[model samples]
Target: MKTLYRYISLELVKTATTAFFLFLFVILINRASQIAETILGQGVSFLDFFSILLKMLPAFFGIVIPIALIISITMVFLSMESNNEITALKSCGVSIKQISVPVIILGVVASAISFYSTMYLAPKSNVEVKRDIERLVKKKLTMSITPKNFSSNFPGIIFYVEKIFPQKGIIEDFMVSIQKKDKLITIFGKEGNLRTENDTVFLDILNGSAQILNWKKPKDFQFLTFKNYTVELFKFSSEERFNARKYQTLSQLLKEKNVESQTEILKRLCLSLSPLIVGILIFSIAVSLPRGAFGTGISLTLLTIVIYYVLYTFSKRLAFGLKLPEIALLPDILFGALSGLLYYLSIKEKLKIHTGARW
Candidate 1:
């Protein structure tokens, strides 16, 4: 019994490790591709790109590890069932519950790791990534602004770029709009060039026009056309709202006590427990069905993972939109209860099989 238990434990762990790496690899590639377009286009140093990648890693693991665990355990057990190892073990007096504890323990460990990542590492990493981005935007102005979209990343200002030329190092159709507390400024240019001094970004525009308006007096507006224009693109400020709720630690979040912080806390809790809950659901299905039939387990596993993530996304939207943190736990609670019911029925089926064979 000891040997059998050890073998099962090792197999599950080994399989889970493989699944974890595979899924992590896929996620890394996908995530890299998504951000690469925006960040890499700037022609930044490779070290900066690598730093960004590392900072973003912990933020995703909390969500992906659970799916990896679900897939790993389900795949291994279903393979065993397909090969009749489970049937043989049963014939030799091994109970499903007895053999399954190892996988469940592994799932628990995965759950704990997920919880830690979501509650601690994720928030820290998010803050680090935000800081990294803020620093980068300040350090490299031309590379930081992605052309063709409105970006509010700059402190207290929003701007849009129409076209960017890396080879010629020119910006075409340059337009900037800035609104300060008491003043509003708008500038338009046919073309512009960027200059960096120490850590500041300066935009040098030729054949441009500027309009100034006093916000307090709407009727006071002045427009001027110029042959050459110069302006500071972005200045780094510690007062920027980079301390977002998502990037705050648990203590910080609790102290905020706002709907946003409450939403994040519940979302983390739901995400942390999702693995164990989904694992149970997968186990309940894998145990009762014949594994080799149409790869139903794989299909269901994928479906469950998709549905699980969708639930979180929707829950997050609802929680923030409706100002309700309780809604975040809806999916977790519903799936957990369903998993229990399925597991109960599966155990009953196994018992019936055992009894019928004796008769």
Candidate 2:
């Protein structure tokens, strides 16, 4: 029994590890072009691009580990059933419960990994990735801004320059338009210098003129001239930038009291436990199905993944839309109940088979 358990566990671990990396690689390849455009297009170095990719793994792990576990369990058990190995084990008095032990153990481990990734590592990585990208953007800002092209990278402001000397951090014929709630503010300068102080980027315009036009009264317009004027392009402060839920850690999320935070907490917990729920469900289905059900098993696995994620996404949207955090638990509850029912039926079938053989 020990040897059998070890053999099964080893096979499961090997297959699952392989599948996990393979799936991750395929997903990275699928997103390669988009990632390249985002990073390389920004003129970020290759090292920085690779670093961002590495930081992104935790987010992928939270999603990919459970998927790999389910696929591995289905493939292993279905292969065993197809080759009559399950029947041979059963004939030797090895019960379905015994066969399930390895799967349960693997599920627990995978669930732990998923929990860590989602609750801790993923959030931390998200913040780091954001910070890194922000840093790269700030570093490459001069290079990214094209002369004679109006750039809207800064929120609520559009700026154009007739000429730019990136090395000298100087601009000629700098023009900026800013939209306000009640009016439009436009600034023009013959020369300007770009500089950064801490987290803020500032443009100091020389010999500039400002024009303000009121939206409510088209005839009401104000114009002013100045020797020097400064415009704050943007800021990257942590308090304002990192306030999103995705950038928050588990402890940080726990301290917040709001509908979104509560929903996020529930969603993370449910996602963490999904692997065990899905593993048991697939295991029961694998054991109960007929020998020649390999195609059915694969189909079922794919369908289960699709259904689970769809339900999860819908529940999250419903929860946020209705401001009810409990709605987020719907997917896990439904899947948990279905898993229990299928497990019961599989055990009953095994018991009946044993009794008939004895008779």
Candidate 3:
């Protein structure tokens, strides 16, 4: 029994590992174009791009591990059943429940990994990825201001530069228009230098004059002149301001009291348990198949995965729309009940035969 268990567990582990990497590679290839456009087009360094991809792995693992487990379970059990190995075991008094021990253990292990990635690593990496992208955007914007054309990349501000000295970060004949709620503020500078500090872009204009006109009263205009005037061109969010539900850790989500947070918490927990829930369900389905049902088993595996994800997504949307966090557990509850029913039927079918013969 020990040898049998070790053999089964090792086979499962090897197959799942291969499937996990294969699925992950396929996903990365599918998204290669989008990733290149986002990272390379922004002129980000290769090292930084690689770092971002590494940071994204936890989220990918959370998605692909469960899939790999399901595929591995289906493949292994189907092969065994096709070869009449399950029948041979049953003839020797090995019950279906006893044969399922290895699968149940593997399910628990996979669930633990999924839990860690979804609850902690994925959220932390999400935050880091957002910060990295924001930093890269700021870097690109600072160097991308084109001369001889009107630039409106920054919100509420437009820049028109007659000439730019890229090496010195200086602009000549700089004109900027600032739109306000009830007024228009324009500045004209003979020369301006650009600098970035923290999350803000500062343009220090030399020998500049400002003209302000109230929108409601065009006749009420104000004018001022200065040797040096600083205009904040762009500002990115700081760490304190970078708060989103997807970017929060499990602990952070638990501390918050709100509909979105509660919904997110339940969603994460349900997703984490999905592997075990779906694993048992798939295992029961696999064991109940007749001999030489290899193609059917594979088809059922794919269909089950699709159905589970569709139901999960629908339940999550329904939960959020209805503001009922408990709805997030619907998929797990339904699948779990199905697993129990299938297991019972499989065992009862074996009992009815009473001769340990292949069905």
Per lDDT, the best of the predicted structures is 2
Off by over 4 Å in 3: 142-195, 203-230, 237-239, 350-359
lDDT of 1 by residue, 1-359 (tens): 88987887787778777877787788778878976776676756678878988888898889778887888778877788778888898899887778768767877898899988988898889888888876765555666556888766566666678898754457888678878779889889899887667656678899989899998997989999998878886555546564667777778889988888988899898998988898888877777766364277788889988998898899888998999999999889889998888877776665222212112
* Model 1 lDDT-worst window of ten: 350-359
Clashing pairs in 2: none
Local accuracy by lDDT, each model: 0.78, 0.84, 0.82
Tens digit of lDDT per residue, candidate 2, span 1-359?
99999988988888899999999988777666667765564446789888888888787888899999999999998888878888899899998888999988998999999999988999998988878777876776665566788878677888798987766578899788888788889999999887788878888889999999999998989999999889777776657467888888789888988889999988888888888999999989887767777788888899999999999999989998999999998988999999888877776665222212112
lDDT of 1 at 303: 93
For each candidate, how many residue pairs have backbone atoms clashing (under 3 Å)? 0, 0, 0
At residue 94, give the lDDT of candidate 2. 91
Candidates sorted by lDDT, best first: 2, 3, 1
* Candidate 2, RMSD to the unseen true structure: 4.6
TM-score of 1: 0.85
Error of 1 at 20 (Å): 1.9
Candidate 1 whole-model C-alpha lDDT, 0 to 1: 0.78
lDDT by residue for model 3 (109-168), tens: 998999888889888888888777666656655345567788785788888889876555
Off by over 4 Å in 2: 142-151, 159-175, 180-183, 187-194, 204-211, 214-230, 238-241, 350-359
Better of 2 and 3 by TM-score: 2
lDDT of 3 at 239: 48
Candidate 2: residue 1 lDDT (0-100): 97
Better of 2 and 3 by lDDT: 2
